[model samples]
Every structure is written in structure tokens, then in C-alpha cells.
Target: MSAAPNLVNLETVSKAYPDQVILDAVSLGVSAGQRIGVVGRNGDGKSTLLKLIARTEEPDSGRVVRTGGTTVASLGQTDTLPDASTVRSALFGDADAHEWASSPRVREVLGGLFGGLDAPSLPDGLDSRIGVLSGGERRRVDLARVLVGSADGRPASVTEGADLLLLDEPTNHLDIEGIAWLAAYLNSTKSAIVVVTHDRWFLDELCDRIWDVQGGSVFEYDGGYSAYVLARAERERQAALAEEKRQNLMRKELAWLRRGPKARTSKAKFRVDAANELIANEPPPRDAAELVSFATARLGKTVFEAHDVTVKAGDQVLLEHLDWMLGPGKRVGLVGVNGAGKTSLLRTLADATEDRRPAAGRVKVGRTVKLAWLTQHMEDLDGSWRVLESIERVAKRVQWGRKEMTAGQLAERLGFVGGRQRTLVRDLSGGQRRRLQLARLLMAEPNVLFLDEPTNDLDIETLTQLEDLLDDWPGTMIVVSHDRYFTERVADETWALLGDKRLRMLPRGIEEYLERRAEAKSDSAAPAAARAKAPSQSTIDRATQKELSKLERRLEKVEDKIAAVHADMAEFATDPGKLTELQGRLGDLERERDEIEERWMDLAD
Candidate 1:
């Protein structure tokens, strides 16, 4: 294999703010085809590092070197598209249909993002005014323009195929399917990508490396998010051990550096060992079984129920005749397309509407259900108030399970430290404001939480803390979020709002939801002639069809069993012997499932 060429480099880069140092003498390089994920707490130089590399902002001391003619494209946290321009003009400038239509990459980008220029979501199609679009629509347009890289009507291959892509929160407004499509699209491209996002799943799916920015320095890691986490734990453990042995800070640092002769050679093995040791020594973040038991004791049986409920936004029926039951201590994650009414259902269940009315049916809440909604809007907050004041206004002390936390303690956990709690809400950044909102939400101590897009503007560290807090929360919770990692981490089961006015539980979770969406899109887009050429089910022998159905059922059972086995492995991760047993069982189950899948494919063909 050939080595990837370096595309960009930062030499001893140092950047700082008036109040704090952002980066200090950090050196890094971006090689061709390197997919890197940047992670840290908010305001910890993540965006600064991207800006320095992109040369949008100069480092105070060091230099950023880019290869000659290496075009760099970036999407900031906010939209930078001209509001006066139409989507067509914004994407391809004066290029006519013939110019862009000939480019397969352009077409794929269009199809994947905006549904091939003919989607209903674009009422005027490409001619839609940028100013008239919603925030999410605008975000998608900006992203498409950057990905297309065709303002001069040239093909993306000619303009951006091997260029450097610096995207900040590119997945902010994207749904799960959109995110999946983006990961696949970026992987297929030849460009070197450095993306700053809180989406852990995206990082794991796309990145070949990770950069952890903290305390004014960047610590490099070898692999994806999961690998970075493992390596980081090991690094911290080595630091801790050095401190313990030497009891001297500088000597401890030196000791850590000199501890391992083979560390440089066997880093991967070291990380694997670290994972095993950490799993065995550390307790699970939350006790799911205990939380459920506690929740049942507190909230009795029912949390919320909807019978024949219908919800509409203007003339569009978002949900229809939906019937759902929310049991005590259940945690559910709701997902769908951008406008698929996940939020509307949340509102209905929480009875947040002005008139307590659903378009068709009724909602019932149990007497013991104390619901608190963490909405998407930050307008509910008083900008004049300080962070601690805002939290204290809700309650000075909140009960989380059996433990009681003071306002300051809650603030600290949510990332607001000593002086930060005193900072006025008006002066806080977007991510800080979000943390404040969550702190306030928890102060209410509701047994039922309806969290709408709670992961927005939160960094990976804050997200980890939030997930940890939720683990101990003994409550019935419903969350609507685009962040797949957070959803899978916090919710026990997944459901989808498929625009059929029905809330469907996904037995196989979000992956099943993605598959259903893909199938729907494929069915809609199939050519009539292609559909007609396929053999009809009635033409097949009834017995063979039955056998195929039987095979499918068995395959599903085996796959579910495989998922169960994996979960069991996580539970027994601390025990080496038990993990080895589960690993063998998992291997056997996977082979059996693969055989069934192959048989089904052959029969179908």
C-alpha cells in the first residue's frame, strides 16, 4: 500500500482568547484521505483548531501550511449562504441544468441530501429562495453547496474530490438517514475530512483518527471514537499510576513516558488490555434493572397513554390515529424524518399545547406522572439571570434518585464551574446556554421527562455527563433527538414516526428504522419496467414461498439472539472467562444467521 500524502500541516500553532488560552504550541498534519474527528468540551479550542487549520483564523504564533492549490471547504456552525440567492444559484452559480446534470457526483449529492431536486421538501425545487427556508432547510442547502463544490458549474471531482473538507457540526440538522448517507458519501469521496461534531456514531463510522483538544493542547489518538476512548483511559491510568509511585508531578510525567519500553510498539495491545481492566474495575454507569424497579415503585403502573390521537401542522397530517402506551420506568427514543412529527408527539404526550387538545383523540396521564419538558427553544430562559440563578429559580435542591444535589453541584456537573455559574446567561455561548437549560430542567425533578433535541450544542464530554445522569434517573422518559449515539445510550427502546400517523416500535432498533426508510425510498424510486420484470409472489410455488417466509422468521430470531448475546457480553465484560464463553456463542450465532441469510437470498433469486 502507498502512503497518503500530507494535505495540510500546523507547525507549533498557538492561539488564545482574551480570557483563556485556546491552543498552545500544537502541531498536527492532515494527510490525504484522513477522516479525523475533533472532540472536547465546548470552548476548549475544537473550533479554534479547525479555524487555524483552515486558515480562516490565524494562530497567534505558529503557521499553517497547505499544499499548493489544495482547496479547502468548510461549513461553520451557522449558515454562511447569501439570503438573497436562490438555492440553484447558491449551489451551481449560473450553471444551467445541462452542466450539473452531467456530473454524477453532483446528482448523487443532490439525491442524497434534497431528494434529487424534485423533492416535495423543496416546494420550488432548486429555485426556492434561501431566505424563505427554515433553519434546517438552510443548513442542508449550505451543506449541499459545500459538498457539491460547484459554484462554477464544474463537477465535484474536478473541484473537491481530493480537497480538504473542514466541516463544523455538519450533522447538526441532519436526521438519522441523512447522517448515514453523509457518512457513506464522505467515505466514498477522496477528500481528507476533519469534522467537528458531537455525534459519536458519526465519528466511529467515518473517522480513521481522533484529536482530543483539552487544556490548550491536542492529544492525538490512533483510531475512531471507541478506540480513542480506550486509549485515553489507558493514558490517564498510566498518569495516575505514575503519580502514585513517585508522588512528584514532574517525575510522574517522566515516569509515565519511560514506563513502557514496548509501549510504542504494542500500543494497540496496551489499549485492549486497558479496556479489559477498565471494564472489570469500573462499575456500569447506571444500573438499568435497579432504575426500572425504583421507577415502578415511584410512578405506579402508567405514565402516559394516547388513544386514537391525531396531530396536524396546518393542512399536513403529521400523525394520525396513533395509539400508544407508556409504561412505568420505560425509556423510549423517537426518531423519523426531519418533519415527521417527533416533536409534535412529544408535545401531545406532555400536554404542552395551549388547549390540551389533539386533532382526533385523547391523552391520559397518570396521577403520579410529573412531566418536565426540555424544549428545543432557549427563549424560555431569562438572559439577564446568571446560571446559578436560573437553576435555583426552578429549585435550590433537586432529588436525583435517593441522592440530593445542591444547585452549585448540579451546575458543576453540567459543566458550569465556580466562575462560570456566576456568568450571566446573556454572556454564555450557545453550548453553555444549553447546559443551563438542562440544569434547570432537572431541577424540577419530574418523574417523566420529555427531552426534545437535548443533544443540540452539547459537546461530547457534556453529552457523556448527561448520559451518566440519565442512567441514575428513576423515571419514565421519552427523548426526541437526531444524535444516534445519545439516543442509543439513553433510551431502552426505539420508535419511529413514519408519517403514517402511527407510532411504531422498532424491535430491531434504529438500524431497522433506517432499513425501512431505505426500502420505502427504493420502492418509490423503482422504475415501472424494472418492477414489472420481477417475478410476482403468486407465480412462485406456495410451498417454496412458505419455506422462504419460514427462513426469514428464523433469520430474524437468530439475529435478535445475536443482539442479545452482544448485550450479555457487555454485562460480563469484567469477567474474562464469561466474556470468552459469550464470544464463542456469538460467533456460532453469527455463522448460523449468515447461512440463513445466504439461503434466503438464493431462494429469492
Candidate 2:
């Protein structure tokens, strides 16, 4: 660790809103050159604590002290600039843009703050208007303002107004490349950084310290995410031990006090006081283990099939001449840039019927298929209704594990407790609304599910729980998500939404997908002269490419089957019936895998 001074310190800080106490006498400190990640459930005090550290908001009690000459910056949307404002105006505010852009130092710093940004031209550019930019572009502009300071020639150093960077959901609108660039930037910067994000990869790679905001306190763990997991488990074990000891002492004290306490004798009264104190101070019990699983019927061999499909929006063809099929136990992930029509394609597949063709395509849904599609807008839920009311509209009772559970019990397990059930959707936080939508979706028990950005506005705990739910879902799923980690964790492979109006499976995974995209971008950016001199790399015949793709997919699926058979055997080792069945299945899968391997080798030869 480098020798750096304390950047900011909090002393007995407490903050509360009308309905809840967020932070209670919580003290936290940040030092220079420290990269910290903040984690907690939704509606926890993570944001509130960040505000205190940035000095944007004061605590109800106690003081927030910062070192002399220290400066702070945070990526927040509360101060979004006017839509019609130009990029220069957005970043510089009331300062003169010409004065700042002319300075070589300021221009260099700005370029460093936002690398590879095709920002507005020097004097003026029409595309620089904030209203014309995409959501991701607007967020980048805000981030630039945070990092580069004002346009009036702010110093580009720790003495300037951006030494301590406090970011909330910084990676929300960023693509894979932007996220990678951000990770590199954070590691290279000397400023103390504290981030609140749901991106597991980001946290695991960048954070050296983790601060868990739970139970009105901040628990600090020194290390990355994996280290935090182990440390947290050990800490919980220790706490359980302490709680058990307390319970034993409390039980013995109660026995003594109850022996002969009819009269208020001095000895009896003292014992009674001790027992009452112990009862009052009993540690809270751990959360109940929540069981999440689908109660859907068995899926048929075929789920949905699209032939010669052309999925389009307006004049933009998202997919053309695409033939796709989904069978039982298929988990497909769709990835592309924004405005790539991912949700539109999902809607077409879900809404297809025998009477109506879907956007220049023929789609056939298999018999006994129960499908549910969750769009990003969550149009299925009414904004005017309360959480409980919305869920009740779906189902009042659900088959949960070994027993049937009422809506109320299910809601509590999904983290909707007490007044939360009565709270209207409009009044709930973004994460709360997402949970409500997901809870209702799961209640439907559809064997085929279509989801678009299901991880948006959700907490890490909820994400992990959803992953568990999908692992044993035993159904077909197609998910569209920008979360690299989520897709890698849940999907067997991803489908790249290519600009050539085709959806290609990427069995090599996210890294390969990113690499191909980078190569395409670089090739397109090359000068015209260079392109004319270069030989074409697309010399392979389409039929050969198609055949190779088929072999790759089949080989991967067979390998997956072999691994899964072993997993089942290990999981059900004690049951002889299951063991015998698994052994037979494993043998067949092995033979099938060998056959595919031979075919692949023959093709290669």
C-alpha cells in the first residue's frame, strides 16, 4: 500500500428519512489511492452514505470532515443539464467553451477523461446537442463534467475539484468496451474512488476494499470480491457462535429468576433484572432461507420455430432470412448495441399466432406451450396498483417447493414486507418495481420465458437468486441483457445481433464476441487506400461456414451433456434409482459425444 493521507472521514454520522432509518451513527473513512466498492440490498444506505462523503448532503447528526483543500466529484443524475444544451455547455456550465477548448492542456485532459469519444468538433457541431445524443452518450457527457472540472481552466491534479470520485452505477449505460476502458482508467488514477454498482466483474477486478452497507452500519472488508465472500461467511459464523452463547446465558438466567420470584426479594429482583436485559439484547435471527423455483409442466420437444424471418422496425432490418428454433432446455442470450431491436424481435416471437404472421416471417409455437415475455417497459404491470394488488392479479397461491404458499408469504420472501406491499408502484424505487415485476413473472409458471434486460435496477442479491432460479428452471429461456457477467453465468452461449441482419451463436463466449466486434470496428475504420491494398478475408464458402457452425454447436452441446450427467450422478449419489438412471444416460451421452468428435475430426481433415 502507498503512503497516502486520509481523504475523508465520517464521525458518528446518522441519516434517516420519514419512513426509515437509513444510517445510524455510521463512521467510515476513505484514504488516497483507495479503490472501494459499496454493496448492499436495494433501498439500503449506500447512496445516502455516498452523498455524505461527497459533501452534497449533510447527516442528521454528527459531522462529515474532509481534509483541507480536498475536492470531490460524483456521477449523479439529479443535476442533468437541459436537453437542448450543447455538449460544451453541459460540461462547462456557464463558462466560455472557446476559452477552455483552445487550451492544449484542457483539451488533452478532456481527451484522456473520455478516450475514443467522437465528441463535438472544436468550435461547433450539430451532433453535440444533448437532446440528439443517446442515453449512453448523455451519461458520458455527465461523467466528463465530473472528471474534467469546469471550463474556466481548472487544475488537472488532486488540488483540483475532482480528487475523490464517488460514482453510483457508473457502468449502467456503458458497453463492453466502455466498461473495459473505465476499469483501466480507475486503476491508473490516483484519486480515491468509491463505486456502487451491480457489475460483478467490475467490482471483482477493481475493488481492493469492500464496504457492506447493512443494518444501519458499514462493515469494511479488505480485499477483492472473492476474498470478501469468504471473509463474510467466516464473520457470519463467528456471529452465530456469539449468538448461541448469549442464548445459553439467557436461558440459565431465566431458570434462576423463575425458581422463586413471587416476592420481590433483593436477590430475586437482581436476577429478574439480569434476565430482562438479556432478553432485550438477544441477537436477531438470520433470514429465512427462501426457495425459488418454477412450477411449470414438462416442455415438449419443440418450443418455437421461425423460418425465413425478417424482423424489422420501421426501415431498419434487425434480422433477415434468419431461421431459428428453440427446443426444451434451451437458454439463449441476445446481445447488441442499443436500438438493435432486441426487444422488438422478442415481442414478435411471443405474439406470433396462426392467424397473423410476425413481420415477414412464419412462426409456429409448439403444442402445450405456455409462454411469458417480460418487456423492458413492464407494460404488464399497472402503475396505479399497489405491489400486493399487482401480484394478486397474477396468482393468489403458488406451488412452492413441498407446499403451496399464499401471495403474502411469497411477497415476503421476495423482500416485500410490511408497508411495502401497500406501497404503490409509482412510489417504489426502481429496484423494488423490478422485483415486483419479476415476482409476478415467476408466479405465472410459464415453461417458455422471454426476458429483456431482466437485471436492470436489481440488486446483487436478487441477481444471484435469479441465477439460482434459472439453473434448475427446466424450461426454455431467451434473455436479452447488457450485463456480461449475468449472460455468462446463465446462458449456455450468446447470439450476436450482427449488423448484417443475422443472429449468430457465439459459443466461444463474451470475450470472443467482444474480440470479433473490435475487429469489425477496426476494419471499418481503416482508410480507403489501405482497404484497397488488403486482400479479402471472406474467401470461405457460405456452405462450409454453415457446416462448421453446425458442428461446433453440436460438439459443445454433447460436451455439456456429458458434464451434466456427471453432475447429476454426484448430486444424487445416495439414491440407487437415480444413480442407475444417470449411469445409463452418461453412457449414451459419452457415445454420442465420441461420434460427434469423429465427425468434427473428419471435417477438419
Candidate that would win on lDDT: 1
* Residue range 1-605, candidate 1, lDDT tens digits: 98988989999989988989999998999998889999998889998888888777989998999988787777777877788988888877776778677777888887888766442245356778999887878989878877887322342342354388888999977888999999999989988899999998888788889999989989999877766766675676677732332222222222222232232123232355545545543444557788888898888887777888887643346788878889888999999865567766776676632348777898877778888888778856778998899889989998888899999998987889789899998899888888988898888888889898899989987887687678779999988888987887788899998756577999877888989998887775576334333434447787767777667556646654565455455344346788778778878988998899788767768
lDDT per residue, candidate 2, 379-471, as tens digits? 556679999988989999876445576787667666787888998888888778878888898788677788878889887766765664555
The predictions' CA RMSDs to the true structure, in order, are 14.4, 17.8
Residue pairs in collision within model 1: 320-501
- For model 2, the run of ten residues with the poorest summed lDDT: 284-293
Best by TM-score: 1
